[model samples]
Target chain A: MTITILFFWLSLAGTAVFAVSGALQALRNDMDIVGVSFIACVTGVGGGTMRDLLLGATPVAWVNDPTDIIVCVTFAGLTVVANKQIIGRRLDLLLWADAVGMALFAVLGAAKAQQYGAHPLTVILFGAMSATFGGIVRDVICNEIPVLFRKEIYITAALIGGVTLLLLPVGLDDAFKLSIAVVVSFTVRACSIVYGWSLPKYG
Target chain B: MTITILFFWLSLAGTAVFAVSGALQALRNDMDIVGVSFIACVTGVGGGTMRDLLLGATPVAWVNDPTDIIVCVTFAGLTVVANKQIIGRRLDLLLWADAVGMALFAVLGAAKAQQYGAHPLTVILFGAMSATFGGIVRDVICNEIPVLFRKEIYITAALIGGVTLLLLPVGLDDAFKLSIAVVVSFTVRACSIVYGWSLPKYG
Candidate 1:
């Protein structure tokens, strides 16, 4: 029960970070406040919703627990209200925060998939999905091709982190594995952003 | 076998119509030929792709049947070439064609769900999804709230059509039910467009 509670808190924090990223993207696109809030909500929870539906989970997580919605709405509202003052000239900060959120989501998604009896490959896919799908939804909503299909190492980093967790010793503490996965994902993404590292494009 | 063949043909025809609608939308948006073709492919098969993934079907339909991809691509290519001259002044025609495609996909999605042993409600939801999801994806790509969300009668019509099929007498012929459902959905959508019918909203 304690482990579950800890994981839940982590997931909520991840959602908050992703929501901010989405809000910032919408702001950059010059969307209205409503659009910003809508995009943020979709980006933060879209992947998890898809995962739950695919796994045949009933009631869906957000529908059952309104806290997720409240958190997203609050964060999105705050971003919109403080767009110019709060986010001014700090684009780099937003990117790093987003990376942290991505890492947390990847670990949480992998752990949940593992609990649901998904095979390792599927769990990895879920992890990548959790990490990248929010951005995909945001891009799609903003009328752009998803960055995942572009020249980014985003999904790949998530997969690496997920695999690390899955391969960890069975008896090791869950928190340790979770921490390692998150740190690995964040570090890889941060380095990729700083160095502009991306996957090779196919001709 | 005959029934399956009938549905297969119907779905193909639906795809073709959907491709045309997508192409028209892209043209209206002033997209280049490649962009038009890309949007067309997405609108033609996006819903079925989502449905298949949710159902855990291997090798997704388009991947399994090369012909499906061929048909979608060919239609997209043709539309791209002819869009400027042929589709630029045919908004009404595009809407009607899209209605036909929606009707066909809605029934087909329901049929597939039933085949997969989904419950009646789930089958109905699947049918509505088939009709609406492709448009949702198209609108999202176009950076708009999904037309289905804004258009009151669209999804509701599909749901009604699906439920109508579900309530048919046991052992009845599949063709009769499918034809009826398709006709009902198309009529509803066409009339809604013609009369500008919209669901009532309260502030």
Candidate 2:
């Protein structure tokens, strides 16, 4: 029961931060409040929606329980209100929040897929997709190249986390395993950000 | 039984034409052969996938039956082989084929949603999404503004078709109603292409 409650709050936090990141992007592009909210909501739920759709899970997460959408709209409004304070540092803050959200969702997505009996390869794919696809959609909507397809070591971080989770001993407590996975994913992403690490581009 | 076969063939044709359109765009962008095929396959199935996901129809059409993917890949290859022959008129051909595909899919999407007991408004939304999302994904992957959001009369055409189908007498034959809806959508889109008709832009 405690573990379930912990996951619920963590998922809410992840949704809120992702919403803020999307809203910041929309504001940067000079979109109005409606566009900002739309982007925010889509970014918050997009990854899990994609995962559920691929796994034949119906009524998606948001449609079944709209807490995610409500959180998205609330955070989007908050971001707009706080716009002035974060003006110059918006991009930096967005990246950090996104990293945290991505890390959390990566493990969560893999866990959900595993419960649904997806193949091991599919679990890893869903993990990376749930971590990166929201940002990809946000960038695409803003008419930019998706960061996932860029040279950034983004999806790789999620894949590493997923593999780590799958490789853990079955005897370990679920919560402990999940915590380790999230930490591993976040550390890789944080290091990449601070060190400007990237994969080599094709010639 | 005959109606089912007609719908099946129409769906295949729509998939093929959409794939061709996506491959042409990738080729114009100088994408490699693999990239072209990837874009083609995504574009061919993207719209229907979006509709199915939103309507809580899982295992999506392509996953349940791989026929659509097969058709998309075959058409992508054919487009590559015919590249030189259609170089100069590629854009025109793509637009025409896209219009037909969009019209066919719009009615089909609406019909599917109706069968699933979706509300009228939801049915119409799914119809427009099914008609335009493939092109939207294709443009996004290529880092261009989606034509659906351009001033073009794209979604409007699909909406009109969906409403037409819904308003038809309940006594009408299913195939006849679908045929009429497809024609209406196609006519609207064809006129927009020929005369450059567009929606009014925001001031």
Candidate 3:
């Protein structure tokens, strides 16, 4: 179906943006080329990897196809080359792209968990987890507190997307429901970024 | 037969020590009870989890049998209760136990990889990875530089164990070979601790 193809392209875009974000973080840490590539690959695949491993999905997505890994490595190369040429606003741009990818992954991860007959609560958890886990790993590897646990509207958006998909009528087309979920998720994230919204911190 | 039983016991011991070490770390970071339990479970199984996921081993060991998680939670609770009474010497004691666990994991990980028909080099890599990765995850989650990457003989000790296991004659009993590998690995790590051995830092 056309919708399936569209989802494929979007997923690849998500993987690339995530990879670039990871590579940028590695470069900031003064890592060598190999480090940058490794981090990028891990960041791109980490969330899905965690989800799959927990679900007993073996040979995970990247291991089976490898297209995602190729995309990650390619983007890492580009980020390295572009590092000196751009500064300051690059992160902001990537954050926007990351939001799109995060939203897509939220739906995809939830849907996959649902297909596997996971509990409803678990499905939502996987959605937020898959959207946010890679970034958590990236920050953790860099020896920083995970941005997810820090102030953010990130996981909230993913949760919203998952909930929306779960509540949607079964009569709706799969692709149509997924698209709606992605939009809802992306809009919340975009608004949060624009307004600098964040959840309250613990006392 | 006796060797297999001994390995089962040692693996449990390794799991407990790693959990206790993680709980102690969580307490040091002032984490809440939930965070302490979470980190403890992750640290206890993290290395083997990574090995299984990478090897496409489904239903990962911990998920198939909940005993390890129960052990982790129980130890975490004990650590929380014992925190005040055990002060400076606790870490030293835990480190010794961790070295034993690390050695056992190195041999076990390599052996599993070989069973799966992994490349010889990949077998060695998995050995070191399964030995050190739990600590790496624990450090990363706590926002500290991984002790493995820092100045230490940790991974080298693991690699030595892996190589020793691989080179052992197939005619030897599996139990004998495994025990010999563990002894070799533990001795190297013990020496490093006593003598302050470390790989050279980059210039």
lDDT of the candidates, in the order given? 0.76, 0.82, 0.79
Per-residue lDDT tens digits for candidate 3, residues A121-192, read: 999989998888888878778775565653569899999989998999999988889889989999988888
Q: Ten residues in a row with the worst lDDT in model 1 chain A?
A: A58-67
lDDT of 1 by residue, B94-113 (tens): 67767898899989998888
Q: Give the C-alpha miss distance for residue B88 in model 2, angstroms.
A: 3.3
DockQ of each: 0.07, 0.13, 0.15
Candidate 3 achieves a global lDDT of: 0.79
Native-to-model Cα distance after best TM-score fit, residue A108 in candidate 1, in Å? 5.0
TM-score of chain B of each: 0.91, 0.93, 0.90
- The estimated TM-scores of all candidates read 0.59, 0.61, 0.61
Q: Candidate 1, DockQ to 2 decimals?
A: 0.07
lDDT accuracy of residue B1 in candidate 2: 47
Name the runs in model 3 displaced over 4 angstroms.
A2-9, A149-152, A167-169, A198-203, B1-46, B53-132, B141-143, B148-203
Off by over 4 Å in 1: A1-46, A49-108, A113-203, B77-88, B149-151
Give RMSD to native, each candidate.
8.3, 6.5, 6.8
lDDT of 1 by residue, A110-145 (tens): 988999999999998898887877878777666656
